[model samples]
Target: MSKTDFPRRENFCEFILIRSVGNDSYLGNIWSDEAKFTKNGLFKRHNSHYWSNTNPHVFRERNFQESWQFNVYCAIRTDRVVALEFYQENSNSKL
Candidate 1:
């Protein structure tokens, strides 16, 4: 995908890392709408966070054979992710 297809680099602020629970890892990307203003004085105004989760069962169903699996979490706005936390499943606790 082209750079434009993704959120503006200038608008990106930070990434919140979420721990895996039940082999699912959640992640959040944060951004600011004001930073998306173009040089021509036009504001794109699309501020939001992207979240994703990883699931081992889904991966295995897809023919993935990895010993460990993770799910990613996503968010649409900075406020949506007030805090980041990580959790370990019984299988992953040893690691």
Candidate 2:
């Protein structure tokens, strides 16, 4: 989908924590950095992909992660995640 499709919101942040569940031999643990809400109100960045080693086919086959901790700025509305703009904390140049 085009980036524009994801509308940016304001003053929001979300932190997601992902972990492995069982001996599925496919999944892995992951810990994402705090997802800041950009002007569009969507998550900015996602860090840590635990299952990077597995094949795409196998990775998609099973559900393996145990739990997720989402430290969101506001209450989650629906399944739809608000869009946001991503920017570095420290930048020398202007946009």
Candidate 3:
């Protein structure tokens, strides 16, 4: 397969720290419109946040955008960004 085979699909992504229910964790909603995928997995136009493939053409990602941390990402692949996302910052380092 080639990179063109993977269709660009729009989607919304949000991460909630499950341990924050009552553990007093400050991690809150981490949302991003940059949840859209490509042959490169998830990506964001603002920063260099992207997925890393383990092998050639393998869809499984071994590394994530560690620099992304806790932020709402907006994707820009084609020409316009239509996805909407909302998120809050957390005092923790591991979002």
TM agreement with the true structure for every prediction: 0.20, 0.17, 0.18
Error of 2 at 61 (Å): 43
Candidate achieving the largest TM-score: 1
Ranking by TM-score: 1, 3, 2
lDDT of 1 by residue, 24-77 (tens): 334333532112222233223243323445643332123335434332223354
Candidate 2: residue 4 lDDT (0-100): 52
* Model 1 root mean square deviation, Cα atoms: 18.2
**Ten-residue region with minimum lDDT total, candidate 2:** 9-18
**What is the lDDT of every predicted structure here?**
0.34, 0.36, 0.43
How far in Å is the alpha carbon of 13 misplaced in model 3? 26
- After superposition, which runs of candidate 2 have C-alpha atoms over 4 Å from their true positions? 1-23, 43-95
> lDDT tens string, model 2, 1-95?
46754453211221121222344432332322335543433444444244556565543232346422233332222343343334545223452
TM-score of 2: 0.17
Candidate achieving higher lDDT, 1 or 2: 2
lDDT for model 1, on a 0 to 1 scale? 0.34
lDDT tens digits, residues 4-44, model 3?
54442211122223444575533433323433344454445
Better of 2 and 3 by lDDT: 3
Clashing pairs for model 2 are 8-40, 8-41, 9-39, 9-40, 9-41, 42-83
